[model samples]
Target: MGTITALGLLLLICMVVVGGTQGLQAWISLIFNFAALFFAMVLMAFHLSPVLVTLVTGVIVLAMTIFLGGNDSNSTMVAFYASVAVLILLVILIIPIEHWAQIQGFGQEDSEDLEGMSTILGISYLNVAVSTAILSTLGAIAEAAIAIAAGLAEILEQHPKITLKNLQGAGFKVGSQIIGTTFNTLFFGFFGGFLALFIWFAGVHYSLGEILNDKILVGEVLMVLFSMMSVIATIPLTTWAMVASERQARKKFVK
Candidate 1:
């Protein structure tokens, strides 16, 4: 009926036509992921620790997204594990960086929108920023992890007798292929989403230094950077995880 509804229906149709059962599962997982994020926000609004909520929600979202992706259990499991590890590492990196950056709360661009509105919401904006950063990186982290893990798993499936060394090399190759695309995806997404802000800066004739110093721009830049770091971290981690899983499986079979 509505434009968004029409677009959503079209997407669903296309996915189902192209992917069949896996597409349906992916659609369902998308809904579940939305619900999970909504629930996390509600919890955060209720004064629950944002960090804790984010950590727990991260695990749940990763499990749902990776496991429901229709990959075999081994691949999904390794992906999930590597993703969680990346999430934790990202959280650690995000907290201190967010604090040091002091980019929390509404920026000047949001002032008109926040006019006559109280900014005091009782919760720490630092935590909120940290949560936001963590959440933003999750997609990239999960994607990289699953891609590398799934690719490695498929290679192993085809070459059942593949050496751990060869499998690791294959994993690295897969990771290399995806890394550039993932970085560009994140960069363009950030730029496209904030093209208006960039135009605003240009219209105001802001210098490069001033533009870089803007709270809003810096915040977004940090998110993109965090995502890139997570992807970089996830590649090696997922590769290790897949190789470790294979090693374990082989040991059990031999025993």
Candidate 2:
């Protein structure tokens, strides 16, 4: 069997064993997430604006990861809105920061990798850099939003009479618990993802300064920082969104 097929079958088996029907839905949503990303790349290749592609992909991925990941409508809506709000704010911050950082385009070290590519492709590497930052951080932002929303929702469900002030406190407490592991997840995930690249740097006798100043390295580090910031922003925003949503629901039910 092909490697991808084998992996898919394994995922199916594991999901069935772990969560049964819910796991199946999760798997389907995961598949849709990959499809959405693939579609976004194809669109980018066809000269579509990378910013638009990133925005659309973010929406699609958020929908699949929240709605199809077995979340209720309320939770999904909270996740979606919170994520979008945080992403917009992050994008605004990323624009000036990325420009100031001056890490766009290929570095001299990367010239070896782009030997024959024509500059006539007309692609704006700066825009591409911004898009890459957005896309890279998006998954973490979505995950953090969904997690915070779901946690707050559960807290509300368990303590239906909790006041907004108390709920916000509880949300912060819950967020504190999640933040540590979430940050570690991002940290270790980066380490694992770039382990081979790090090895290559060491193999090539790259100096510390060279490694630090490398364009790809700087870009990736910036992406990680951006993702971390998004995840941090997501916690409070999601909590506030859930609290606001709950308040609205309560006011409506009283009428």
Candidate 3:
């Protein structure tokens, strides 16, 4: 209740600061994003299907993109769709790599934590582990999509008459820098959050291969790397989509 009240006050502040009726978009974005997030949490809490949960979350994101921006819906929708496509591709790419590296489930130490619980409850630790691996990447994916969309919009605004070739070139250049920083952020963020786990592995004298190839560790690594890849891939994919759409619009005008 307190958190909700805080968010409401924050929304009020944002509305006042932005002035005019601009607060409507913020409210829409907040409502849809929170709805999606809450849906995911409820699904997890209920031990419902992770796949279904992810799907519902995705639908909310799509709805948010489509409805929030009004006049800017086209660009927002394009970016959101492209981001999702890239995420799907990254997941497909990571599966083989994860298997090749033999990373599955959390480390053996966590197994003890599980053993203490009644095994007859039928909760699949492996499912939970894999779900954690996948869900962890969602934050990166969400951020990347927003970044790409915003970047593209800024580029278009700054150079209203920009040619496709120049647009693509600039996107590549900016995207390279963004991707580098994003990957760095992911690496350090993961390391920072899981530092204790790393210490536990080292103090317990786990071998290099054992530690590196541990399921949980590998899952986290894959989550970060693949999310990074998704972002990088979407930059180009989105740029192309924007370019193609503009060209089609011009052609229609000429006709």
Candidate 4:
């Protein structure tokens, strides 16, 4: 088997051993998630509208993530709605921030890298940048929403009589933990992904200020911050959605 296929099979085996059916479902969802990303890229390459591609991919990925990741129908519904709500809010903020970041095109220092590329690709690089930011942030937002929704669902299952106030408190506690870990994941993930680039910069004797001011670096930092903010915002929104959903269900039952 090819290396990637071998590694994938190994992951499947490990997940099955560790989490059984849930792990298998999670693996399937992961595959679908990757497929969604690939499809988005393919569509965008064909000169399709970036915003439309983003929307389509976001919905598909969210469905696969929530529905195929071992959540029951109710939990899936909650996650889907909460994620969508957070996505809308994030998009509104991302547009203006991307415009302000001013990191659209290749930098003069990057001329060597673009030596063979045509000057006119007939597409707005700014739109692509914004689309990329939106897509990246969407994944984090979905993940946070799904995690919060699933945790809150489990809490309700375990404590059927838990008061709304107590449930909200539980959500806050869980959210705090999620935010802490998620921030670390994003921060270190960026570092790890760019370790080679950092080494190259050091080798070239680029000063810290120059590195920080570089367009690509600034753009990446902005993307990371945008994702972190989305995750942070998702926590409260997901919590509120869960609490409000439960309250509505309780009222309906009473009636």
Candidate 5:
């Protein structure tokens, strides 16, 4: 087997062993998510509006990741709703940011790779950049939403009569706990993925301004920043969603 295949099998084995049935479902959801992303790319290649495709694909990915992977309906719904909210908000922000940054298309580093290839694909690179930024934030938003929602769901189960104010407090507390780790995960993942690029920058002795303005570097940085913002937004959004749900449920009970 190829290295990737082998590693994938190992991961599957570990998940199955550790997580049991839930792990298997999570793994299946991952496969579905991969298919969704592939289909999205195919649609984009066919010249569909990338932003629309991304928005649709993102919802699909989040559905599979949350609903299929988790057994709890309440938490999954909250996460899905909050994630979509964050996704929509980020899309609004990314389009203008991508346009303003003008970091779309290949950078100088990609020049060698595209020497003879046509850079004209007929699609706006800005849209693609916006899509990239939007897609990058989805995972973080979903994760944070899930974490807070699930934590609040558990609190509801335990306390059963926890006040809305206390529930909101719990949500904020859960969000604060995860924020640091999530930030670190994004930071380290970015740093590790771009370590070679950083070394190249250092070796070439790029000035501070040049490095700051580098298309590749700036694009990655902006994506990370967007993701952080989404995670931050997801916390309160998910909290409010859960609180609203509780309030609605209480009203039904009173009736």
Candidate 6:
């Protein structure tokens, strides 16, 4: 509870410093994110379309970005469109890579955690494992999109006269930085979040090769790399979109 409060306050401070316009939008975005998650869980509980639930949640996410994330409605719209493009590309890339890696569901070793969960819910542990694996990756995609949009916006603001090529180069540079930190963040987050499981592996003296080949481990690695690559890809795409939008706006004013 204390940690939550600290984070809330930290977000508030960050928003205030950034700009009231953006801050208000961010707060709204956060609220909508929670609402979407709640709705998604409700849908899941009712055994409704998991795909539909995900789609609805995704729409809500896009709406949140458009309504609460950007400086203007037009900018938000552009951001939303660009974000979708990046997400689609990322999905296309992740789908094949995940298959090539031969990763599925959780590691064979998470059975202990499954015991407590299985007792509470009569669902198959393997299904739950797969669901969780997919769920974990969703946040990465969302985060990368948001970061890409925000970075492009800042770059445009700072260099309104920047040529398209230069803008793209700047985006690549900014994206590289984002990728480095985000990848490390995801990597360490996975490491810290799954420390207990790793300890279990070590305790049981699982071979290093066995641990490396584990499905769960492979999934985590893929999620991190997928997100990293997606952000890298989004950078230039977003920069181009920003340039196009700005040029159109200027043209409108000139006319």
Q: Candidate 6 — which pairs collide?
A: none
Measure candidate 6: CA RMSD: 4.2
Candidate 6 residue-wise lDDT at 88: 63
Q: Tell me the tens digit of each residue's lDDT in model 6 across 42-62.
A: 777776655445555665676
Candidate 5, 1-255: lDDT as tens digits: 899889878888999999998888888887787788788878888999999999999998888788866668988898899888888888888888888999988899878889889877988878888888887777777778888989999999999988899999999999999999999998987788999899999999999999999999999999889989888999999999999989999999999
For residue 49, what is the lDDT in candidate 2? 90
Model 6 misses residue 185 by how many Å? 2.1
Model 5's alpha-carbon lDDT is: 0.88
Cα displacement (Å) at residue 97, model 1? 0.7
Q: Indicate which candidate wins on lDDT.
A: 1
* lDDT, candidate 4, 1-255, per-residue tens: 899999999999999999999999888988888888888888888999887788778877877777777356776688888888887887788889878878887776578889988888877778788888888776687788888888889999999889999998988888987888899888887778877767878899999899988888888889899889888888888888889989999999999
lDDT of 3 by residue, 41-67 (tens): 667668886545655575456456444
Q: How many pairs collide in each candidate, listed in order?
A: 0, 0, 0, 0, 0, 0
Candidate 1 residue lDDT tens string, 149-225: 88998898899999999988998999899988899999998889999988889898989999888899999999999
Candidate-wise lDDT, in order: 0.90, 0.84, 0.68, 0.84, 0.88, 0.66
Better of 1 and 4 by lDDT: 1
After superposing candidate 2 on the true structure, give the runs of residues whose Cα lies further than 4 Å from its correct spot.
Answer: 109-112, 116-119
State residue 80's C-alpha deviation in candidate 3, in Å: 1.4
Which is superior by lDDT, 3 or 4?
A: 4
